[model samples]
Target: MDTGTHLVIGLGLAGLAYIDPVVAADPMVSTAVLIGTVAGSQAPDADTLLRLKGNAAYIKNHRGLSHSLPALVLWTALISGILWLVFPALPMWHITMWVFIAVAFHVFTDLFNAYGTQALRPISERWVSWNIIHIFDPVIFSSHVLAIFIWSVHLMRPEILFPILYAFLALYYIWRSWTHYRLESGLRPRDPTYEPGDRYTLIPTVHLHQWQIVKRKQDGSFQLGELRNRKINWIDRVSCAVHPAVEASKAHPNIACFLYFSSYACAELKEHAWGYEVRWADVRYRHRKQYPFVAVLLLDKKLNPIDSYVGWVSDSRLEKKLRMGGA
Candidate 1:
């Protein structure tokens, strides 16, 4: 989910807190909880500051450590404690409880999207993306916005409204998950060569009808496809064969980090003016105009490394950066 969605969700939770008569009776307690809700909702994303260091650190650690179990507790405590410091006269436990709810909700909702958090870190380093929902769903975000708009006009009581809104959103997730499963089942018969455990990575797009599918086969080949109307349209394919040039390119730091972060990565080795260019990217994000996360390593005619550009580069910027890096 985006930051705006998270912030609105925190506000929704604050509305729910009003259901409790004790919280509703005290304006100071209400202020402390609201403050906690706003800050705690964005605490995990503090890792975005890593962009200052460079894209390498940002891509590698974003949602990895920051969204883990220990980090969740740390964020809740730090944000809640800071609010307690500001309003020492207020009830500390009540502020921490609401703030913890906001922080926990932030981590919980991230699990449903394609770019997931490692919520069970230390227990598992595996990225647990359900791919059930788009990172920014119009339905989810708009519903929250609408509720806030209605509340501002004094149209209804938020305590009664938010629970119903959240309930509808839960049902929406179920409906989307069922649709995703049905569409993916249609792809299996198209390629009967798949064996058990060779499952396709099916991700939902903003458009309800469209889905991105990336499948890896046992024969060292991958297929990228789009699913619409229960039919798949092949977009691209790559072989996982170990070429000498591709093998040597992985020794570079940029290429190594890319492989670690990409869930369904594939590479293309192409001849270039200088020598060779090995391009690597994950098929999950291929729906974008320019692949958001990619690595390009250029090698000389002798197969020795020339230079490389890695991380998020748009179409127009990619060529210029590669040229600059190689020089």
Candidate 2:
């Protein structure tokens, strides 16, 4: 979810807090909890501050440690404590409780997207991406927006309205999950052509009925598809050669960082205007013929690296970057 959606959700949860009669009666406590919820909701994303240094560091740790279990406890305590200092009249326990809920909800929702979090880090560093929801979903964001609007108009009290809104949202997620499974099952290669490395993954788009699919086979062949009407329509196929990491390319910092973050990565060795280009791509995000999270290394005929890039860029920008050769 985007930052705006998360912040709106925080505000909606604050409205839901009015369910507590004590919160409804005490303006000071109500203010404190609402502030805590809004702040806590975005606290885990604090790792985005790393972008100031460069994209490599930012991509490496954006959701790695900041969204982990230990960090969850830390964010709750830190945000609650900060808010409590500013408004000392509020109950300390109340601030902590609401902040905890906001932070926990942020972590929970992130798992539904393809760019998941290492929520169980330290216990297990594995990434947990359910791939059920798009990174940005119109339905999810609009639901929260509508809740806030209704609350603003006082058409109904937030406490009553939020429960109804969230209940419907919960059911919607269940239906989407089922639909995702049906779509994936439809794409499975049921014929005798299934190879050991044959695998498929669906990437959600803005539309509920459409998805981008990437299929890989043991022979290093690739197929891209679009899912509509619960069926995959083949868009194109391309084969990429795979090789053991070339010593020079492997030694590059950008390549190391790209490999660490990519789930289904493939590298292509191609000729470039300068000499040669090594394009490392994560197929999971292959949509609209662009690979955003990629590492491009331009090398000379001797295989000596001339320049490199490790971050998101459009096809034109990537080509421009390679031509510049680290300039």
Kindly give the number of clashing pairs for every candidate. 0, 0
lDDT of 1 at 308: 81
Q: Top model by lDDT, which number?
A: 2
- Give lDDT tens digits, candidate 2, residues 1-327: 789888998998798778877677888888888988999899999999998988778877888899999998999989888887898777778668878989999998899889888899999978888888988889989999998998889999877998898899899999989988877876776324456767888878889988888788767767777887765577776666554334467678878777777666777777646577788877777646776778878778777778888888888777776655433
- How far out, in Å, is residue 9 in model 2? 0.8
Clashing pairs in 1: none
- C-alpha root-mean-square deviation, candidate 1: 2.4
Q: Report the lDDT tens digits of candidate 1 across residue range 139-218.
A: 98899889888777889887788788888988998998888777777677776555765668788888888888888777
- Which 10 residues in a row give candidate 1 its minimum summed lDDT? 283-292
Lowest-sum lDDT 10-residue window in model 2: 238-247
